[model samples]
Target: MEKIKLLLTQYQEAILYIVFGGLTMLVNIIAFWLAFQAWHMNSSVSYLFAWFWSIFFAYLTNRTWVFHSTAHDLKTVINEIFQFLVARIATAVIGFVIFYFGVNLLKQDAQIWNIIQNIFVIISNFALSKLVIFKKKA
Candidate 1:
């Protein structure tokens, strides 16, 4: 128990972030698949829907647990959400570009492209959250 506690104390933020990020990815992929395959939605539209859901989930988890944001007041909460959205939007553009090139231009499979895009987004998002969106205020 003591060893586990010590390990968690040492790497709580990272471990939680990874676990939540993975959940977010799962949400995105499942949503995308449902919209694209089951619902027969347009590819880009499905991707957008998945993006919206995943971002919302990510924000909730990140604010509540991963970064432990202390946005008590309305202004601070709005600012933090704005920052988080901006960072996510930046990554969204990257993902979209990759999807566009891989699917439309190269005629690659959507599933394969989505997997690749998520891999990049996950890595980039962790950096963005740590360095910019969720950086502890000095």
Candidate 2:
């Protein structure tokens, strides 16, 4: 975390966000791929498997490394966690629904839908984390 804070002065935190986001996306992709290819699960099940992994890792990384804040009390931690979960879960539901209708039902490319949803979710997650959970330093 200290190293991350030092890097923030020399590098854009967006780079860190992207790196973490990319790794977290890998978790999602692998989880979803396994659920679908191995178990032949439904789209929702595959999405949930991936989404849960992404959400958990994002929270862990953002709280411990990215924000680098140590002021969190138990109450604040719980509140931030609740908010983060709501934001990610809502995005997941929205992504799945849009993907279903736009890609699956319409027979369009699923990758396109997934990319679109990921973009939206990424922006939302950044704003929420920066503003609410791991707010900017004074």
Candidate 3:
């Protein structure tokens, strides 16, 4: 129990991030599924809708819980948000390219491709947040 507690203490942020990441993925997947399957939207359009909503959800959770950002001032908060959005946009572009190749060009399953893309996005986002966006102030 002590060892388990130590482990949790050491990696609490990561564990929390993973939990929230799963929720973010759920949001993304559900939005995509609803847009594409239920509403019969174009795949690209559906992906955009999912991306927008997921980014919003991810930003809220990541800023508040995952990274515990303390930027309370208007300028700092704006800067933090801008940086986060930039990183997310970069990942989104990568995801879009991967999805295009996997689903449109190679004729793979959208669901499967989306899952794979999200795995990459989650890892990249974590690294970006930890290293760049929400790094601890020295």
Candidate 4:
């Protein structure tokens, strides 16, 4: 138990971020699929929906779990969202272009490439969320 606890704490923050990211990505993927396939939305519309989904979930999970900022409420969350978007607009634009090209244009069947692109977005998302959205304890 003690050893387990030690190991858990050692990787807790990283593990939480990873899990949260995966879940958030799941939200984005589902939204994308629904918008594109089910609702018959255009690629651009589907992409926009997915983008906003990712952004919202990224802010939410990162703030509540990764950063553990219990002090902030809805107003703070909104302000942080604006800041996060502003700082990440460039990174996310790049990420979206890469992801969209790979998934929609290239039609990448290789899971590796898709995963790699998603990792880039996740890393970029984490940086933005940490520095701008829900800053970690100082």
Count of backbone clashes, every candidate in sequence: 0, 0, 0, 0
Distance from true position, residue 24, model 1, in Å?
A: 0.5
Q: lDDT score, residue 73, model 3?
A: 99
Extract clashing residue pairs from model 2. Answer: none
Candidate 4 or 2, higher lDDT: 2
TM-score of each: 0.72, 0.68, 0.76, 0.70
lDDT of each: 0.89, 0.80, 0.91, 0.77
| lDDT (Cα, tens digit) per residue for candidate 3, span 1-138 | 999999998998899899998898899999999999999999999999998898889888999998899889999888988998999889978988998899999999999999889888878989999999889999
What is the C-alpha local distance difference test score of candidate 2?
A: 0.80
Candidate 3 local Cα displacement, residue 11, angstroms: 0.6
For model 3, state the Cα shift of residue 34 in Å: 3.1
TM-score of 3: 0.76
Instruction: Please provide, for model 1 over 1-138, each residue's C-alpha lDDT reduced to its tens digit, 9 standing for 90 to 100.
Output: 999999999989889989998899899999999999999999999999998999999999998999887678999888888988998888878998998899999999999999899788778888888777777889
Top of the candidates by lDDT? 3
**RMSD in angstroms, all models?**
3.8, 5.0, 3.5, 4.2
Worst lDDT 10-window in candidate 2: 8-17
lDDT of 1: 0.89
How would you encode candidate 2's per-residue C-alpha lDDT over 9-93 as one tens digit per residue? 6665577788898888898898899999999999998988887887888888877777675657898788778888987777767
